[model samples]
Target: MTAGDELSDATAEYITANDIEHVQIVGGTGAVSADVASALTTLGVDTVARVEGDSAAAVSVALAGLANDGCGDDLGLVSSDRVALVRGNPDGVVAAAVLASSLAGGYLVTPLVVGDTLPAWVRGCLAATPRNIGADRLNLGVVAVGGTAAVSEATMEAAPDAASSTDALTVRIGAATDTSRDGAINADDPVRPDTATAGTATAISATASPATGPVLSLCFSDAVTATDNVDRVRDVVEVNGIAAVVVNAAGNAGSVCDQSRIDVTLGQTLSAGDVISVDGSSIKLGTSADQRSFGSATATVTAPARDRVRPTISIVGIAGAATARSTFEIAFGDNVALAGTALLANDEVRIVGGPGGTSPAPAVSVAHEPGASAAVATVSRPLRPGDRLIVDPGAVEDGSGNQSAGTSGSAIRAQASPRINQVLMSDLKHTAHATWTVPTGSVAGVGGTGAGITIRAKGDGDAAGAAGNGWSMVFDRASTYSADKPLDIGVSVDPKGKRVTVRFNNGPATATLGDLIAALNGDDKFAALFSAGSPAALWRLPTMRPVLCWAWSRLATWLRASATPVAPSSPSR
Candidate 1:
């Protein structure tokens, strides 16, 4: 059945009534482990156990043992060789044991330490006291019916013939000090004085002892003597009883005789009371007279030598005829020095060419010489284009200065002069005519019809005005008849009229018109003028038979005021 299927009624009732915790089954058996566990758990069992083994029979044997034990614990079978008890349910325990025994040959019973807690099913089987078989020595064999009995009866036994023992050896100390003593007296004797008198006889006594526990006494005194009475003595006794000598002295020369000569140096110069020790002992004394001397020595001194001074001069910008006469100044830096010797006059001075010259050339002149400030004394000379002045400080001085020429020099070209010219508009010439034409239906004089005017610029030359040269123009207004109509004319100039003019009928117009036109033409202006708008209302015929009509009577008056031409005689009629 699928894992979802419920347990059979008989199995479920048996598990519940018996209080079985879990059921264990071999995986290869007809009953699947998970299915059996689920079935038992559904009836109130909560755990299951699996056993590990090599064969199913070993596993079955282990399960059978658990079943006969009367335990109600969940049991589980793991690897074909081993079984585990999961809970304390009778069915689970029995099933686990039976399964383990069935897989006996494949099963391996793991050895556990004594007192280790076991699962419920295993514990129940052990509590039943199962019979034991001779499978205990087999490293991985299952105990099936006797697993618990065999484990409970096992014990750890020690091997036979084992023992331990101990032993000791003797140790001794060796002598560390010499037993042989030289014929010497110990200073520790009460009759011996620790301090010796200077320049007098005194005694030294010492106690000698063996370093090993017991010490022997040698009471003898050695005469203490000093060069001066104030000497003091210091002595060290060796382990072999030999005494070393040292000495010191007080201010008085006769105080300690024993130590008086302890520090004495024979034949060598010393203060009268200097301490002198006997060949083998220590003693010291103050000086009988003060007589010690020392001398002082002297040290040497040194100074740095002075450096030789050299002077140099540099010059620039010597060029052209004018520049040839030009004096090129030379500068001397503080680092330069001048010799007292005067530079010969007329000594050649080097001149370097400037940008004005085609190539950099070194030119020499006989006019200049070195001056006192380490500079060359130069006289103005005419220079050529591209000529530059440069000074070289040679071994010998030039009369120009005490200076010598520098290794390098520089120059720049003279700035070119600027040329300027002014031209006037009057100088400009107009090659073509400046003409204006009346519009269609318009007359050249007087007011015309409402036709516009046209202006044409044929050509122009010398736009810049020159002296006595200017532009001229002619304007014509024609008369015509039109009712209630006035003629208007407008003019303008481009580029804000810097050079433009206006005139009427070939004559100068009034200031009013001129001003208005000027304002209109002033830097982009436009202006217009209109004739009187009043129109003539009357019309009349001419006295002559040819029949000429006058639009206004003023026309006759206007014609009379004008100059008329005389008529010539007609040919034979």
Candidate 2:
């Protein structure tokens, strides 16, 4: 019976009358039941022949096998090389069955089931068999039938080799090779991958360290993956031939493929001097149609050496005078520049130590001229006295791209400036003791003995009752009480005018009676020259009145006495 669960009496009678001897079963057990077979056997039918397949595609392939085999050329006319590919779903398979069989009347057409990627089995079948023309490569064409999406682009790619190598594979949308909406097709530049076993490596570079995380870049001459994919650097590439030990496929290492460029992060930290080499064969460019191994064809650069030596600063300064805040200057001993776009001013410079030093000073920005030494930085807040500055190990680089070794500078102040507090005897004699704290900063650069002030001019007020008879101190370096409004600050003994002049510094218009008394007593020179009733004393000079007296805490005073109040070992810290 052509198709029936139960045969009609006429068909049975005809079968019996004709004395059918050999009955053949088609379409497997699903189409013809055992009962029917038994019935056939009972009807004296023997030597039953059956034809079936594991799946619809398999059955179609079997049908193709049974058809007349012929050598198909690149012509549109059908022959044996036609392949019928279906979607992986069951419905897609059953639906495409009729199209596979008809093929303008059962011409040898291959049927295949494929999903996301091209089926490996199909590639194996095609690559193993050469074209009927005996050519190593065949020109193939795909006539997509039924609804569109019947076969994937990858499957169509396999079609050219087996069907018509030079013909463009037709892309379809809705249904039928004819009248169906067309999908994108690049006739000028087909989807054919290059014949090279692997892509070529254009160049390789190493950035030992930068504001951004360190990375090694290996760029390729072709697209490696279907999309952008970045993972462990050691994945596609295995580091080799380098000075240091580098593991392959390290879980910690990372890499990304952005088309042709492969940015990599090695498992190990790259230091000042590292020679890196990537294995040429280890690169995963892509495999051939037959699932063969793939690697880079050639590497433009291998074993690129890392930066040598750390950067050093020649001149490092922060407005030490407390006059300048939020700004500092540093000049590298060698030609220097900032490195990496990822660098933030805050990342490059870290304020270490105190109120300003240890605090998280939000750096606004850092500006620098290429090859210039100093880089100016602006901060959100003002920099404090204890705020010390240091360079990040990798932020600053020399002309050669070597990273900075990292360094810390002293407090932002000129010289070891001191804050003094003294007490007087009130005996009208220059006899007093002083105490001061000298914060770390500034060396003995054109100033007092680092933190010491030398006493000059000796002897007490003259007994002759002159106005300026007392030995007085002179200003080593003239200074001002303030920068905004100029207030002269210094002490001088004018013997020609018979007067001792002193301009108080730092604050207030002038020195007071107590302040003058304290200065004279605080100095060893004043104590020796006008100690209670020594030659001439402040109270004993009836005709002489106290003159200008500048009290110095940090400033240096020139006098005849060789003694100083305080001596700080560290001029600057």
Candidate 3:
């Protein structure tokens, strides 16, 4: 009722017909004036009282023949958990009252709507209501009457923790989604605020509560019909961008009038920060005014993410072979993000490396899509068989803005590179001899396999190397030997003459053979091919025959064979 208004005739008649015993006017003068309650006194049937939101106001009015010492401390509502979390929305309260209260007593409790700010009436009731000292503690057992959304855990935790007396009103909150308790019912409406007229472009301004039975209110430039109205309303009205089935609709004025408002009672309750929208352009209003709809409009969603749990990450998979820029696929258990100042400032999504020899060396960067649980990270260096992914702490967050813990992912696989193996040099067709250089492990990294060595052999007439495939040393018998004549031929290498000189030998034949061997062995270039003491079988017959001849040649010349040829006389053959 307004400041000077009285109860309507219909409401008065309903009150009388219902055989109601008590009338408790809720709210202060600002809401319904005292004059509205006076009508109840005139009926002369039962008690009339007023309960103001000012929970602890002192009044000194005298009343005779009435025992009014004070209300005792028997907080007699059978909620095993001391706290009776009633619905904060009016529609929900009405539903709860109808189910829990007797017709004789009037139920008038202001709804709790705001997220962080508790209603004054709620505070007063909590402070004044006596708590049950069960479960070995004196704390409030917060039981969500409907769904957890009925009263969010975050919201209820913000309430006052102390009563006016010595007892501390610490709260023990349970799951808000818990529905096993008594009086749990799924309300059939979503958040329905006051009407938003299309012509007026009136911005919606009302808070909704109760996890079940949410309400959302909207107005068309022209009135809509009741036939198939719910279906029509659902076609245009949406919650979070999806069409929602409307359970009820009425005009704002009166139920009897066709213009009576159609309040939205969603089958589910409204969560904090939910956006409700209406496609006014698609609506068909039944009126004489303009049929133009109220374009697209958001119902309202005005709170930040208040999720209570933190997010965590795990590696789902790696893309192909790991390389310097390998993609490490990761996942968090909830919707995650890496945007905004908080996320960016802390490098919310980054890959890290440790002291171990890891593939794709550290200092990795992370990327994520909005409202997704998955992400990809880029590594800095070539990946090794031992490479594993690690995420930095506070690198990502969930929808509730909870940061993730430092996490490690599964190991990445390194590509197996091709290797070289050789066989032994043997005439047999199936010999198993071999030789090689590189092994097969982690060779093809981000830079890929490197260029290997190339080799080619010179043919018989090819330019080959200098000195025409190198120098040569050939030996031969310069002169023939005889038995009677002393050895006349001795071996010597003539560097410039290019010949093996043979003549009479005055010293031991072995000395000459030693000289040839010494000269050949002295040169480092020839040592590899013909070492002084190599196996004789490995050498050619021509080379070895000359050395044998020189080794045992008689110490005589060809002319002085018989009787030592007197005075250099020629010997007869």
The number of the candidate with the highest TM-score is 3
Model 1 segments beyond 4 Å from truth? 1-309, 318-325, 334-336, 343-348, 352-371, 374-381, 390-410, 414-573
State the displacement of the C-alpha of residue 260, model 3, in Å, after optimal TM-score superposition. 16
Worst 10-residue lDDT window, candidate 1: 158-167
User: Which ranges in model 2 have alpha carbons more than 4 Å from their true place?
Assistant: 1-48, 52-54, 68-78, 87-110, 113-129, 133-140, 158-573
Per-model TM against the reference: 0.16, 0.21, 0.23
Best-performing candidate as measured by lDDT: 2
Evaluate model 2: give its lDDT: 0.38
What global local distance difference test value does model 3 have? Answer: 0.38
Candidate 3 lDDT, 115-153, residue by residue in tens: 334555455544543322221212333333455556666
lDDT of 1 by residue, 46-147 (tens): 776654343333344454554434332333333322333222223344544454444544332322222123433334333333111121111111232234
lDDT of 2 by residue, 363-427 (tens): 54567665554666555566556655677676666556677676766444555655332221222
Model 3 worst lDDT run, 10 consecutive residues:
58-67
Ranking by lDDT: 2, 3, 1
Go through the candidates in order and give each one's C-alpha lDDT.
0.29, 0.38, 0.38
- Model 3 misplacement above 4 A: 1-306, 317-325, 335-361, 369-372, 412-573
